[model samples]
Target: LLTPAVPTLTGLMLTGCYKFKAMKMDVIGVYTNKMSTDAYRGAGRPEATYLIERMVDIVANELKMDPVQVRRLNSPKPSEFPFATACGLTYDSGNYEAALTKALRIARWNDLLDRRARARQEGKLFGVGVSPYVEICALGPSKAMSAGGWEWGCVRVEFSGKATVITGSTPHGQGQETSFAQIAADRLGMPIEDVVVLHGDTNVAHYGRDTYGSRATVLGGTAIVMCIDKILAKTRTLAAHMLDVKPDDLTFEGGRFSAKGKSVGWGDLAPAAYVAKNIPPRFEPGLEASSFFEPENFTFPFGTHIAAVEIDRETGEARIVKYVAVDDCGPQINPLLVEGQVQGGIAHSIGQVLFERTVYDEQGQLVTGELMDYALPRAHDIPPYEIGSTVTPSPSNPMGIKGVGEAGTIGATPTIANAVMDALYPLGVRHLDLPLTPEKIWRAIQSGADDRGGDRIPEADRSAPRYTAADVGDGALQVGNV
Candidate 1:
């Protein structure tokens, strides 16, 4: 929405940063009579990353080179921190090799080499694939965004030491409230139950962008910390006066202020601040602070995802035997939350490449609008992810956190696609597009209907594609219109 054209839709993420000589990306935005296209789960980065990752495997097969070696040779190293790619963007800091190495270990790449040899001898389809991907997140450098990209957060402490945080990023179900509370409680040295996070009411809260582009924790959480800083500064002055010591001499821990040999609990100190009794000179009467924090640069969250799968040559069915993901979204505040995000994103990505496809017919209508026609992956369709991580903190943010919400989705699409291609490579099949249905694989094996482009299925009802009232102008849906 910031620009007339969706610039990043073509080439934004690490596609431009790969350092491959004489690399060119050609992108075209087309206008169709069907429904307008917009962001999917991972948005532009996933599509662009998937394309290049798939091409890397294709080039490896053509050159008789190992895919892992090919990627390792091309990926930038730790020495190249803040390196700019041919695509006209700079990477702040990352260790692509470390993440890839961890992913390989989790994926058991060494064992896969032996498995491939034995599977070939036994006439079985077995393969391993990897996609090392980086996504530009925290959608910042507000100037580049051309509008609103900052977050607003405010913190207020009651007289009883209870705290309330209001963040601009309203999260529906991302567990943002719980994470934000954790940060506040740790910073204030208070019990977690004493701190509460609030959002969803813009009228009562400050103004900023809502939760999209995975900006909640990195942007909104940081904003809350900044606001807490203001409160702490005011409280420290009050705390010092109550302890009868200099502000610098007072130290805080376990919700108590200690100076030399004297200490005061938050329960006693908090109410004293508002009471204006023995308060520090020029100190405020109540604790309330607000901060609108704009991230200096966008966070680049990178990771490697590996997939192992075996295909049934007889019926052209694909089964994911094992899946491994090694992601580094910087210092994780909660490991379970990070793992859950990776798992959910992997499921979404795998679904897109295997079962889900938005199809339009010759009449410019959506054929898969209903669940009966649409083929989303069910519980049985997706495999469990074995997740691991290597912490390579970002230097851009104070918390050194990079966004992980979209990392799994960014890495999984190509990993699964490559695994399928690896399984079919012995049969001379190299490249294929998404929604790798059994019919396409069987055709590619038997008669070489090499999968190209997206779903090409015909409309189920063979009816006219989306002919809305605007198109009819005169609003006439007669018997023949069907």
Candidate 2:
């Protein structure tokens, strides 16, 4: 909002190129003086989201409103579909209230609040937090990419009912193999097992670049849709040739190109009739198609997450008691895959809020770079989570899907952090940093004396470092050296 001169880091970050377009709006940005950049896992979106949900708890404390009620009052209404926010991004579709309410029900929000109240009366600490998130993904078509220097995909499907999809998109473990195959199977009317998806090799694939920004489902899937259409078109032609019928007379369904109202299956006419007597005089017997799709706008997927925590005031340990997420990704292609994505994202979020961080020492050398030092949450640390979704078909795509990949992470971090903060609010604390360490929480409790009057500030709380660094003096670290 405050149109300061662009920072150099903006030029360095690929996402920063889109920041200029954002500045035309009429609001003030908090981090204007600092250089901005985008990292993997959509750091900017997640960070700001964490900040906002944290602030919601702050407001709830001040107004004495139930945190859930406060959030409901401030949240975007469901009627606000395709709504343009002050930030200039257009949200395609969402029902924010429904998602939030459903998540609360699944988490038993009221029951937890009662428990927390009882715990507080018994001089224990308990809290619950909810984070509703909206993220833009599935980057639009070629024109949208050209404007932001974003990449689009090129995909091809070959003849002989065998598909070789060459996608410009690459997967670093987002399950492109499973989900993309599902899309191809449904699109081509082929059994899910029959379709083959190819990606990641720049030599073989065409018109794509590195994958990030949660664009794979939107952009990459569009490319696949395009390729499938061409393959279907050619298959229709081949069907006409083999059935001695016009291309228009042949219809595709359930992996079979059939003459409508006839029992003959398209699979029954093999490469023989397709290549020999029954085929049209000039048309080829084989089938194939390829294309580049450019969408006009980005798809926005939204969701809500709720977390319940039990805190030990003595040790300053916060344990998750319950978790629930209600998401709407706009017509899910695979329900099980969507559930997995949500669960994985939530785990990452919980890790960030409670245990995970990257750090460096005064000399700016990498420390805690190894997994032994880097804390990732294990299964034992996580409580069971209940997940549910609502289907709102996207108007933008023919397939009606919006990406669900990052929803849980974007929603869970703040939810867990807020719950922890709510549990400690009675101890007279307001703000804290990520990875809410036991030492940090214990110190905060001890340093906080009975409040006499006005708020206190010591420039900043400097004792709680962002993260710990390894003491690797002389450019080396040693363990139990035998």
Candidate 3:
């Protein structure tokens, strides 16, 4: 079976930053002798981002041009969105240049360059890397997903004048409980403490497209909003009946319905809904609603990440001195939650780039299968992050929310890898595979060789292979021997 990662390879890769005239992607899933690969954090997005961002740096280095300038020249302007990419996906909304500019400003880009120069004078390796990335998320419309791409939410007002929200989107630890409650409470004009959110139980929420691809807030929260609207419509009609006024004459505010100097609060309305005594004609005797929200399209969350690193010439140990990330994931419901998600995601990316690795011997047996053998990042390994955001509300949903759960992971891997490459570039190291371990860096520094064991070519003399006319057919360029 083709996993979600397959389409992600093409859909996300070509649309990260640049606007390509034409593109093609071929997926060849080789069945290895050992275990099969499955989805991880960011799925295929991190790999796609790594490929494009690394190529941007390579192109910049070869042409002696600023990578930032190259990116700006290729990126679509803000007015150009709902931009359709050559990869057969349309971006809902973004301000790629704005995110990039904010990240650079926060990182003090020019000052970082000067610091690198000074470090070089002191016989140190200081490198700065920037990666601007865009990820497709909010799971999406049913037409695009095989399993179905809708979320379920139910809101029921209890007799106690409190609300209970049951969502189909399961939250392991993304703080959906708090964020969803906040969303529901605001719409109901009730105290947040009066709302209770429940999920992760199939018996409770029997129908839903559970959370993945950062759809909890966008798809799931929108579903809740839809349910709330339905509940309010019924409540207004019932309230007008109780007040002996037209539904249009009744206004709702602060959990109360008012008409002509008379008002009824949720406390009174809830009991009336259950009692069924003199309620609205032909109306249901309960205050509850359920919704299944299917989004029109996926949300596009873009961001810029900048990393500053210092490499020890003798030990080949790289230390991240500074990190800045500026993301645009639409209007945040809770800024603190966004920051926590980004910070956790960056830590996950750092582990993949610098520490975590899986190994197999020539005999195809697992080697680093245990924690003692494999590595994971510790708290100290994560550098302090400078978090920032630019709001570009998505047009795909009523809440205008985009996803942020995977943005840091999607952007940080390339940013950190590029920084390490930049630091090793002066030592004549052209390329190195991850996880950029200390031994690998030291070996590369000593041999001054590329990953393929070729001698490093000078910038002026180096040349990349060109695609011929035969390689282009129907505006698509097939890469590799697949």
Candidate 4:
């Protein structure tokens, strides 16, 4: 729908809202002080994405629009590079249309009706749901930072050639080690294993505010490159003195210095410079450098995801059958490591959708104390997922890279929850809270009943009796039943 006959109109399209076929010109109502927000996985995107996806099925049933077609109507086209969404984010680069198209093809969205018919013939509720989203990440640009504090990095390559990286960003799970090493080694032309990453020790890694806003890569990685440049400058002077050549005549390569095609290297020149025997008297024993880098703006990474599910009407239970994700984080430094980040993030979201939620009692006592009571999704809970991507390099850094650490968590939860609601729609359910427990789904399944609201909580399924502080010892417990 955004592909207008007049190119000027494309600039004003509300792509995300258009894609969902909904318009709320006054959505800023949720931003008030008291009820505004706090942090959670995926932040606000999870809630908004869930809302759109659930509404897709609802609108489909109401006006009979096919869910996929309804989505296609609003998807931003591949040609919309640097497109600006009404939310005020300039999507630097993306292929939203292709991502959605690929996701639907993989999900076999066209055959969903046939499968649903077969399932109905066999007495089951089946449905497919999709959510396409984008993440604005890699905090930076002093102006962006000034708006919300700033991110800082101080990279030092010691006199001993040992490296220590200090950044204001602290990572709890993102793999900064691997990424930092790649940046340092490639820039210095040293073996990757020789570069060491150090952070989180303010006394050692010393510097700014801290991580959490995903600022490490664009800011921190660029600082490593700057430090390498400093090291090369000093090393070149030392190399020129030892090689008996002009400073500009020497070049460093393969971890050594060469005099413009002459066969001598920096290793061969090191011993002479150390002894002051056959070399200049003013050179140092080892290479070292340090730097602090701050960029001009944050980069954006985006993607699309599709979730499919099956609901058992008899038990009111739903299970994710398949999850398909397509993400673009721009220029991967390590594909394997990137895939690991995406996969782990999706699992985190899956746990949130069907199993995990922080709960508190009326007395203000925390109810879910232990892992067992918290309802975490284990390995057996998630179905196999197909993860793929497309690259749309970010121009914010020389490496042309963007962050992938939180992309999966940013897009998967809503996709799964939306699918669950789609499966239960025929049962007269319009909305359901997350952690769709079987009892809640079963209650929704029986919403159309006139005689009874399904069976009462089977005594077996009622909340298991609660244990009190007086009921147990360190290694032994008292039980009334069993």
Candidate 5:
């Protein structure tokens, strides 16, 4: 709530670009009798998307408008880049409509009528929901944030032309190690195998803000690029001396410097520079450079996600049938890694919506303190994700790249929540809060109440299934009760 990361989820997207025409959000952070809420996964963005998306469905139900059409009507057009919102924020670049259209096509949204009708005949609840989300990344212009939002990088080339890169952003399973290495390799025109990226230790890694808020790649990788530019400049100078030509006349490619048909390979030039036997005057003996890059503005990465789910009315258990996501994080350096991020982030959001919840007793004692008390979603809980991307390079950055680490998490939560609400539409259920447990769903279904005001449940509302030890049986559905 207060002073948490991303104090406002996405005010620019909520007030500026969302097609709602009229919208207002009032956030009040209050000290709770329970555990203090803080950032997790997508942080505040997921919660905001969930509530806004749920409101969209609720309004759609009142107006009988197609949810997809409603979204399409309200979103900003592709030409609306640099769109300013009612809140004090600006969207850098996005094609929100394109992403939504891509997700819908991938999800086969237009063909859902027959599917819904067929499910109804089978006495089942099948619903589809879409969420278009925008995230502000790159940790930004620095002025907009309280923390020092800048990245540092250093690139060093040994006598053997082997490259080592040190970045400020440390990788904690987000593939920063590999991605930063790839950037160095590509920039140096060296084999990917020869490039090594180092981070996580203060002695080794540059002075960095560390990893969080999807800044590792967008900001950290850019810092690497900046440092490599310095390395390349030094290389060109030494190569000019070795090739016996002016540095301006030399054109380097494939890790070789050529001028006037005279060529010098990286291996030859690196050793010559370090040896300093025949090098440019006043030049350093080794090839090394550092860069501290400060972005002028934050990069905005936006996307759309669609979730199709099925609910078993008999038990109020829901299962995701299909999931499609179209994310645009600007020119992906590695598509394979981006795909992994999208899938993994979706899993994180699904866990938050369907299974993850923290509990506390009335006296403020932690109730769900252990892993056994918390219900994290398993691999089987997440359906296969159909992932797609459209690159719209950020004009503010040199690499035109944005962050995708949190995009999947930001877009998937509301999409799944919306789908679940849609699944229970026939039962007069408008919304149910997070960790949509079966008991809560069952209670909402049976009582026809929109019990979504808060996460606090009465003691009578237990977390376990309503079967006692005596009801345990081998063949039955546990005494035929749920």
Candidate 6:
């Protein structure tokens, strides 16, 4: 499916940190006689990041070089902004080294090394892992997207001096309402409560790209900004006419327009614009504007995530003792919202790496069809997160914001996986597929085998009859014979 293929191709192109002299990729979508795969939280980004980060660790182990040094030696310098990858995408702006530095400092890299040594002395399998990831977001130019890449925004300053922002980008739990309000309030110099954000209603917001690929804030918010700029232009003319001053002479700030000695606030001018009296000649009656913003290039958000993992020798259980995430999504409109998104994404990553999995039988029947069979990370499964940020503004938009929606998921998956792999590397385990289960780890430790293919159930167990729910009464399910 196009949905699956897009991310798959994206991942294939972005599988390495170093600039390669030559590279080739082939995408062959085959029918597995199973349900079609589609986009997930991080889509292809997590898979791509996992591939590169694990390979980096593997190379480090082989060369006896520090993984950090390997990264530093190969990464593009900060001056290489608008850097073009050999794979055919141009990064808007980034400071990969800065993010890495911040993450390492926050994670206390030296102390972590000492701790790992001490744990080893105690006969423990302790390891530290670091992953620096850059992901393409804000969708891109319209030519690259099957669907239109631009987003629409409408801003209307009501007669009561309150504002309403209608955007095509629909926000689910990413808190776009609050963030959009913040943007509008800050730009209009009005109270945050005075701005109301509306979306996800087709009748209200007739046109939109509908908020995927972390384009809500970058594209949609920028559209709102464009609308605000248009509205301000009209307001400036109206204020200049009313104040009997040249438009260039009037300065607008704090919801008020001021001249040499006279000023007009929103309360005075908003009603005047509608009243059509004492306003600029040929001025629009309503204080409203709409804009559609199409970004010229994709904004690349890069970050570094470090994880300290400790494995129990006896049980094969791996626990993350510490985690540090330093991300750069340009400037955060709301730090709280960004933090919440990152925390949720990190939890999602943790689930994907250690717990979540989908299984199938020889007949292509779904084995892990329900939540009871598929394990998800619980509240206690997450480690305390040390979150930090670097601000490397993208030139794609005036706000300079990239997207943080998928940053945590993209960065944390490989960070934790690399840590687990690092711990197993000492035991002669070279490679393993995801959802590093206890049994798999224990078997690897015992046999020194690589489970790179995936978890395989014994044929007898795979063919065994399994329980399925029939009808349920009184909240009790009746088990049906398989």
The C-alpha local distance difference test score for the whole of candidate 3 amounts to: 0.84
Q: Clashing pairs in model 1? A: 365-465, 365-466
Residue-level lDDT of model 2, residues 104-210, one tens digit each, is 66665556666766777787877777777777667555554535424444433433544556667787778877788888878766677766777877677756755
* Cα displacement (Å) at residue 274, model 6: 0.7
C-alpha TM-score for every candidate: 0.90, 0.80, 0.92, 0.77, 0.89, 0.91
Ranking by TM-score: 3, 6, 1, 5, 2, 4
lDDT of each: 0.77, 0.65, 0.84, 0.64, 0.77, 0.82
Cα lDDT tens digits for candidate 6, 114-177: 7766776676788788999998889857998886889999999999888999999999999999
- The pairs that clash in candidate 3 are none
Backbone clashes counted, model 3: 0
Candidate 5: worst 10 consecutive residues by lDDT? 473-482
Off-target runs (Cα >4 Å) in candidate 4 are: 1-38, 111-113, 145-150, 154-168, 233-253, 256-259, 263-286, 448-482
**Model 1 accuracy (lDDT, Cα):** 0.77
Candidate 2 — number of clashing residue pairs? 3
Instruction: Give the Cα-based TM-score of candidate 1 against the true structure.
Output: 0.90
Query: Which of the predicted structures, 5 or 6, would earn the higher TM-score when compared with the native?
Result: 6
* Per-residue lDDT over 81-155 for candidate 3, one digit per residue giving the tens place of the 0 to 100 score: 999988888998888878888887788776777777677667687788899999888986999888789999999
Off by over 4 Å in 2: 1-38, 141-160, 244-249, 260-278, 281-285, 449-482
